[model samples]
Target: MKQELRKQFGDEFQYEIALNGNEALEVVDELVEAGVNVILILSDWLMPGLKGDEFLILIHAKYPNIRSILITGHVDESAAERVKREAGTYAVFSKPWDSTKLMEAVRICCNKN
Candidate 1:
C-alpha cells in the first residue's frame, strides 16, 4: 500500500508509517510538534494494539481537521457506521480497493484541506 501511495503521489506529499496505534499516535504528536499540517490518515480497522475505529475517534477528537479513511478486510457494518458518524471518516474501503477511487478520495480530501 505504501508503495502504491508513493507511486501515485510521488513527492507531492510526505508519507509516514507506524506499526501500531500507539506508534501512530506518537508519530502524529511528533509531526504536530514539527508543525506538519497533517491532512489525512488511512488506517485499517483491525490493528495490533488499538483498533482503527478507536484510533480514528481519538484523533478526530484532538484534530478534527485531519480527515481519515478507514480500510478494513473484515469489519461489521455498525463499526464502519460508527467511525463515519463519530470520527467523521471521509471514506471506508474494503481490502482490494480500487486504487483509482482511493486516489480520487485522497485528492478531494487534500483539496478540501
Candidate 2:
C-alpha cells in the first residue's frame, strides 16, 4: 500500500507509514516538529496494537483538522456506523478499493482542508 501510494503521488506528497499506534503518534510528532500539516490518514481496521478506528479517533482528538479515511477488509455495519458518528471520518473504503475513487476522495479532502 505504501509503495502504491508513493507511485500515485510521486514527489507531490509526503508519505509516512507506522506499524502501530504508538509509532504513528511518534511520526505525527516528527511531522509537527518539521512544521508539516498532516491533512489525511488512510488507515486499516485491524492492526496489531490499536484498532484502526481507535487509532484514528485518538489522532482526531488531538488534531481535529486532520481528516481520516478508513480502509478495512473486516468490519460490521455497526462498527462502520460508529466510525461515522464518533470518529467523523471523511470516508470508509473497503478492501479492493477503486484507486481512482480513493484518489478523488483524497483530492477533495485535501482541497477542503
Candidate 3:
C-alpha cells in the first residue's frame, strides 16, 4: 500500500504499513517511546484480527490526543452508524475515495500536529 502511495504521491509523502493491529500498535508505541508526538492516523475499517473501528477505539482509549480517520469500502448503514456513534473518528471516507480531497484533509489535519 505504501509502495502504491509512493508511486502515486512521490517523495512528498511518507508512509508505513502494518500487517495487523499489534504491529501497528508496536510501531506507534516505539514512536512514542522515542519521544515523538504524532497526531493523525489513517486506517482501513476492514482489517483482519481487529476491525478498523475497534482498533481506533483501542487507540482512542490509550491515546486520546491523536486524531483518527477511517476508510471503508463497506456500505453497510449499520456499520457506518456504529462507527459514527461509538468511535471518535475525524472522518469516515468510503471506497473510491477522492485523492485530492483526501490529501487535502491529511494536510489540514497534519498541520495541527
Q: On residues 1-113, what C-alpha lDDT tens digit does candidate 3 reach at each position?
A: 45645665576644667877777788778877887776777888888788888887788778888777778898666766666566667677889888766766666666722
RMSD of each: 1.5, 1.9, 3.0
Ranking by lDDT: 1, 2, 3
What would the TM-score be for candidate 2 when compared with the true structure? 0.89
Comparison by TM-score, 1 against 3, better one: 1
Give lDDT per model, in order.
0.91, 0.83, 0.73
Residue-pair clashes per candidate: 0, 0, 0
Better of 2 and 3 by lDDT: 2
Best by lDDT: 1
Candidate 2 per-residue C-alpha lDDT over 38-66 given as tens digits, one digit per residue, 9 for 90 to 100: 98888888888888888888888888888
Judged by whole-model lDDT over C-alpha atoms, candidate 2 comes out at 0.83
TM-score of 1: 0.95
Question: Lowest summed lDDT over 10 consecutive residues: which window, candidate 1?
Answer: 104-113
Q: Which rank order by TM-score, best down to worst?
A: 1, 2, 3
TM-score of each: 0.95, 0.89, 0.78
